[model samples]
Structures are given as structure tokens and as C-alpha cells.
Target: MFYRIITLKTTKEIWQTKRSESNRILGIVNNVRLFGTNFSNSRIFQKLLVIITERFETTISSLENINDLSTIILAELLNAL
Candidate 1:
């Protein structure tokens, strides 16, 4: 999510707007910091690596079946043409 408020340079208005903008930027920085910390602690990358490895092994084991299916489809397409 993104938000922006454009304000012309005025005496008091500029000061107030600047303060709000500074606060908003600080809030975003803090949120990103927290998210990075949590992501590291969760070890999500390791879990994803395990899942991808298992899926890849499964695919490799089934390559013969996949090849046969692709060959059948290609022959059918050529016949249609």
C-alpha cells in the first residue's frame, strides 16, 4: 500500500505536513525492520527449499510418463494438421 499527500509550500501548513511525512516514513521503516526480523526467525527459506526439493524429485521420477504424454499429444496435433 502506498499513500502520498501533496502540499504547496506555506508557512504553517508546510511545517505540519513535513512532520506528518516524517512520521509516516519512520513508521514504514519500522514496519519493514520488523518484517525482516520475523522472516529471518521463521526460517521460511529452509522450509521452501525442502518443499521445492521434494517437488523436483517427484517431477524427475515421472519424466518418462511426461515424455510419453507429450509424444502422444504431439502426434495427435500433427495428425490434425
Candidate 2:
């Protein structure tokens, strides 16, 4: 049986411990760009998606450096309400 692993405490920990390392967006884009489409029918890829997605969940978020994110989005996200 296939089991999906997920936990809020663990999610919180990774978000706090690692944020910049997260690359969910890049993976998704790569999956689309390279393979033309490679998300569905791929459990391994799905797991990767979840792993990095959890990075977005955090009690606190910060942008130590600005990248492609717009100023408005960065400001709203870094100083979340």
C-alpha cells in the first residue's frame, strides 16, 4: 500500500530550518519545461512537490534577498499579517 507522509510539526521544522533551499517552483517549472509535462502519474515527483511545498508553510517568513518575486508580493509575504 502506498502511504503519503506528512506532518505539521515536521513541516514547521523544515520551514524554520530551511527556506532558501526550497525549490518547489523550480522543479515544477523544470518538469513542465524539460519533459513538456511531468507531474501526473509520478509519485516520486509528487513527493518532491510536497517536500518543497512545505517550505512555504511557516510561522514566520523572510526574504533575506530578493529574487524574481515582485516588491509588493515580497513585502506582503515577509511581513505577513
Candidate 3:
């Protein structure tokens, strides 16, 4: 049915949006990991954190939507820093 098709399309769009957001968050986390200790002092890293918080309305704790691997990596990086 047309309604079912529309619902499926909407679901796909939502999934894509979540995927994009997760990728963006993962990239930021990787960058932080690469910076290591320097990340805590870097102005750019601070800005990225602000952006993540403000734009995504997400904190490190709220990244449960991301995959397990990325979540683990982020957790390790957080611990390291």
C-alpha cells in the first residue's frame, strides 16, 4: 500500500540520519583519540565538544545509539584522557 511505502521510506530516512550523526560523532571521537592528552588543551577540541553538545544535543553519555565498536573506542579514549 502507498501508506506502507511512505512509512518504509520515512523509516529509511530516519536510519540514514542516525547513521550520519553516528559517523560524525565517531569521527570527532577518533580525532580526540589521535590528539591524546593534547585534546584536553586544544581550542579546536573544545570547539568540537561544544558543537557536539549544542548541535547534536548529545553528550558522551548519550551516544548509546552508536555501534558497539565506536562506543568502546570512545570509552577508551575518554578513559585515556
Candidate 4:
């Protein structure tokens, strides 16, 4: 989980709006939060309202699948087990 609040010059009106935006953003994304913005009434809001999708996990190998072990090492591991 992560949260960020960029600070910039702002008035009270925009502060309330961004607070609501934070909840609305969390409703859709699993782990995220947003606070006041540096700019109001700008396209930054639209850009921020993006999915920002990307790969979360990558393929990794575990000891159960040690397919590239040498014969001697394999024998040693089996004997140690």
C-alpha cells in the first residue's frame, strides 16, 4: 500500500474536493491514496485518474524446480535431504 500528497499553492475549496477524490480513488484501486494536488482545474487530475496498469508479479524459480543442477550436486542434495 502507498499514499502520496503533493503540496502546492491551494485554497480551501480544492482541498475538500481532493479529499473526496482520495476515497473515490481507493474504491477502484486496491492499494493507493491521493491527497491535495499541486494544481487545480488542470489536466493533471485526468492524468492521475488513470489505471496505471502494469505487471505486478514476475516468473521466479524455487528449489522444488531445480532443473539445471549438475549430477554430482543433485546427488549431494538428495543425500543431505
Worst 10 residues of 3 by lDDT: 63-72
Off by over 4 Å in 2: 1-21, 37-81
lDDT for model 3: 0.48
Candidate 4 C-alpha lDDT tens digits along 1-81: 112223434556456555554454445332322454343322332332234222101111222244333232322322222
Ranking by TM-score: 3, 1, 4, 2
When 2 and 4 are scored with lDDT, the better candidate is: 2
Residue 12, candidate 3: alpha-carbon lDDT: 78
Predicted candidate 1 versus true structure: per-residue lDDT over 29-69, tens digit per residue = 45646776654412332232243334245443444344443
Q: What stretches of model 4 exceed 4 Å from their correct place? A: 1-10, 30-81
Q: Which candidate is the best by lDDT?
A: 3
- Write out the backbone clash pairs for model 4: none
What lDDT does model 4 reach? Answer: 0.33
Q: Positional deviation of 38 in candidate 4, in angstroms?
A: 32
**lDDT, candidate 3, 1-81, per-residue tens:** 223235555777756655665577568756767867454333443455466544434443354334333224443424322
Local accuracy of candidate 2 as per-residue lDDT tens digits, 8-79:
356666565334333433455456658655444334333433454443444223321332233334224333
How far residue 31's Cα lies from its native spot in candidate 2, in Å, is 0.6
Candidate 1's TM-score reads 0.32
Instruction: After superposing candidate 3 on the true structure, give the runs of residues whose Cα lies further than 4 Å from its correct spot.
Output: 1-9, 38-49, 53-81
